[model samples]
Target: MEFLLTVLASAVGGVAAGLIVARLTRGNMTGGLLGGMIGAMAAHFTLYPSGEQALPGLLVATLQGAVGGAALGLAAGFMMKKKT
Candidate 1:
């Protein structure tokens, strides 16, 4: 249950960050979305703080996920952009 909740929170954070980055950068939304999900999931599993309470843990997970997502989304968007 807790793991599932953490995954869900991370995913939501990823999606939001992806959309925001895509909108802000005018980059590929699909790339942003995929990058965001990958980054968020990676961060959630690897970097999530240990031995924390429920709400705070989830919040921390979400924030880290968002930061990871935004970073990867930006990179992916930049790479996928068509040169014009």
Candidate 2:
């Protein structure tokens, strides 16, 4: 189903965002994960279109989610309060 595919795509996007954030932030696992979740949630709400076919929609959602998630994660990284 398109819904499931959308979730999967969002998860993949989250994981990718997490990894990238972790690497960029010198291995902040918790920050990366939380950022990824926020990013995924953002993509889920923002990108998924209704009544789409399975494969193409999945592909589109994945790409959109990936980009959106990364951008959001990056922004969050900058915006989040630093713990000193």
Candidate 3:
């Protein structure tokens, strides 16, 4: 139950962060959102703090979402770039 809620929250956060980053950076929203979702999930599992691991406080979660969204957006940008 907790895990499911965490995932759902993270996914929603990821999507929101991704869309914001995409719009700000003029990148593809769909790609950024997908990448953000992956990164958010990865971060949640790998980098979450010890002990109180119940969805990470609002600030932490937002930070996580932003970091994940930014990282994914950057990756998407590089991948979408045309080789010259």
The candidate scoring highest on lDDT is: 1
lDDT of 3 by residue, 1-84 (tens): 655555566666776776677767767767677777877777777765452554576567657766776677657744664556
Q: How accurate is candidate 3 locally (lDDT)?
A: 0.67
Model 2 bad stretches (over 4 Å):
49-56, 76-84
Is candidate 1 or 2 superior in TM-score?
Answer: 1
User: What is the per-residue lDDT of model 1 for residues 18-84, given as tens digits with 9 covering 90 to 100?
Assistant: 7689769999888899888988887776765452343336787688789889988888877888889
Better of 1 and 3 by lDDT: 1
State the weakest 10-residue window (summed lDDT) of model 2.
47-56
- Candidate number achieving the greatest TM-score relative to the actual structure: 1
- Clashing residue pairs in candidate 3 are none
> Over 4 Å off in model 1, which ranges?
48-56
- Model 1 weakest 10-residue run by lDDT: 48-57
Candidates in order have lDDT scores of 0.79, 0.65, 0.67
Q: What's the TM-score of every candidate structure?
A: 0.83, 0.64, 0.69
Q: Can you give the lDDT of residue 79 in candidate 3?
A: 62
